[model samples]
Target: MKNNATLCFPAFLIGTLATLFGGEIVSAAIYSITNTTLTVRYDDATQTFSVTETATGQTFLIGGKLEGEAVKATVTGRTIIVTQADGSTASLELRENVPFVFVHKTLRNAGTTTTYIQRVVPLTFTLDLRQPAAEPRTMGTAGLTAPDRRPQHRPDHQQANQAVCSSAG
Candidate 1:
């Protein structure tokens, strides 16, 4: 019986080891976007975030205790709405794969009359996803090291200038 007990214990340990090492591991990549006006950091594992609106020097954080997680964001239709604890909200309009505008609207009341004011700020930046084994690169210089040799769409100079002038109005 003593010999049988020793053999059973060894067999049990071997089975445990096999179970522990028999599975595949999956990792999530970190995604980020940075420019002169804004910076965004997102962790794919936890769906957490840390973002900064550099133009207004305001930082909005979420999903971590040390970072204060005071803001909550939700996507609705083509917009991402970020609401803070203080009741202020910033709405970002999505275009294609990027955000095109940040809009903030406020309602004010004076002398029994209510007025609504809206502010719109345009954002122009490319979303950059980090590769699992790659090092971080500087903003606006990610693809500069090895430029794409493929021909890109180049509009006619006169037509482009006319379109720009027309849109300015």
Candidate 2:
């Protein structure tokens, strides 16, 4: 038989909320955190983000832009660690669930006849105070497309500047 013991009021309490997202995210955020760490749970898989604090008792939740470019992100327990100088770190699992989004849009110029496209991709999620995170792969597969045949223009110049266009017909 399972021990049904809560005879007295417990001191440690954990709070949580159901996460919802719109705009550009279409995935669930399943991440966790502890006093010294933050964790992510996904389809039976697990990852942990790490954090170190000199103080205790007071819970905390921090958010920052995650830069996982040209690399695979791996989270083991509840705190994420960096290896060297360029490494950036953030903490989770203390105050409230957090949500973040990073959008990536891609445009393909096939055939080369039509030349103009613009794109915008958005990813969003709620960070659970404990074991809260969405799989990077779960990021919305969304985007906007705009193409410019003026490939000869500077990378920045390639961007359309309607403000500078003349209206002559």
Candidate 3:
């Protein structure tokens, strides 16, 4: 009879070694922990990201995503709200009808031993925001009351004029 077990032993050992050393060697490797990791979706226009812990009752909002995490944003009215998108299942604390606000996050785990199996790092993120429209003010384009920076848009009416002329001619 052929001894297949001996032949497969080397393959099994390699797999075991890889599993233990792969992540240790690769510092930036992204790992998944079934129900671990904090994800947030941001509304850039509003400057907010909805934050939540997928496995726990923790939830919040942040101005941006962490360094390695992906973030997206949207703006509405005077307020912007963010949402955490990396998580498969998480609830956003911002109500569409409510005023704009931010929520901070802190990590806390109970007596569950499984909480230590962290494939993703959990960070205590605090959401601090700035308000530009805090007071009612007049807006102007050509005066001393200009903004710190200028907008970049051409005043050329070439496109509009061309369309009108073509249609008329």
Candidate 4:
């Protein structure tokens, strides 16, 4: 529901990659969309993103590298459709009151001949755990020495698990 998110990083390395589509990579403008708990910013030129925790003002970036170019991005309702230069598409959907954003990506063959994609890394998170607000929390438990030490954002494990599982499906 918040709309004041900005794009600035203090702990990341930004680098550009050569174009993969055999055409000039256009530097598109940056844009953002928010869910209930996080604000996500995307650089269309690099096809990279940064996530900011809405409550804590903590920001995490795609560490040290960039991806392919995004030719277009369309925001429809709570979903963002991004079209890459290689004919692939990635859709980012944000649900109301949900902290997690679901991503669905489709890879396509841009060229006339058949090609193979060896590896695809959506993004790499470089977390700054040194910050006091970035300290990890052991949810649904009082002590860290518990038998099952699961790092969860929500206080209830059942709800957290359900939220993650359902959203991922």
Off by over 4 Å in 4: 1-28, 62-67, 111-116, 131-169
The order by descending lDDT is 4, 1, 3, 2
Clashes of 2: 39
Candidate 2 per-residue lDDT, tens place, 61-86, comes to: 23323223212222334332212122
Query: CA lDDT of each candidate?
Result: 0.33, 0.26, 0.29, 0.53
Structural similarity to truth (TM-score) of each candidate: 0.24, 0.19, 0.18, 0.52
**Cα TM-score of candidate 2:** 0.19
Location of the lowest summed lDDT over 10 successive residues in candidate 4? 160-169
lDDT of candidate 1 at residue 81, scale 0 to 100: 46
Between prediction 3 and prediction 4, the one with superior TM-score is 4
Q: What is the clash count of model 3? A: 14
Local error of candidate 1 at residue 160 (angstroms): 34
Report how far residue 94 has shifted in candidate 2, in Å.
13
**RMSD of every prediction:** 24.4, 21.8, 24.6, 12.1
Which stretches of model 2 miss by more than 4 angstroms? 1-26, 35-61, 68-75, 79-169
Better of 1 and 2 by lDDT: 1
- Give the per-residue lDDT of model 4 (tens digit) for 1-169: 2211112112221111233455855456555677667766666665666667778877754442334456787677666667778666666666668777666656555334434343455435665555564356643455653324554454554443331101111
Error of 1 at 76 (Å): 0.4
* Of candidates 4 and 3, the better by lDDT: 4
lDDT of 3 by residue, 6-31 (tens): 00000000000112364464222221
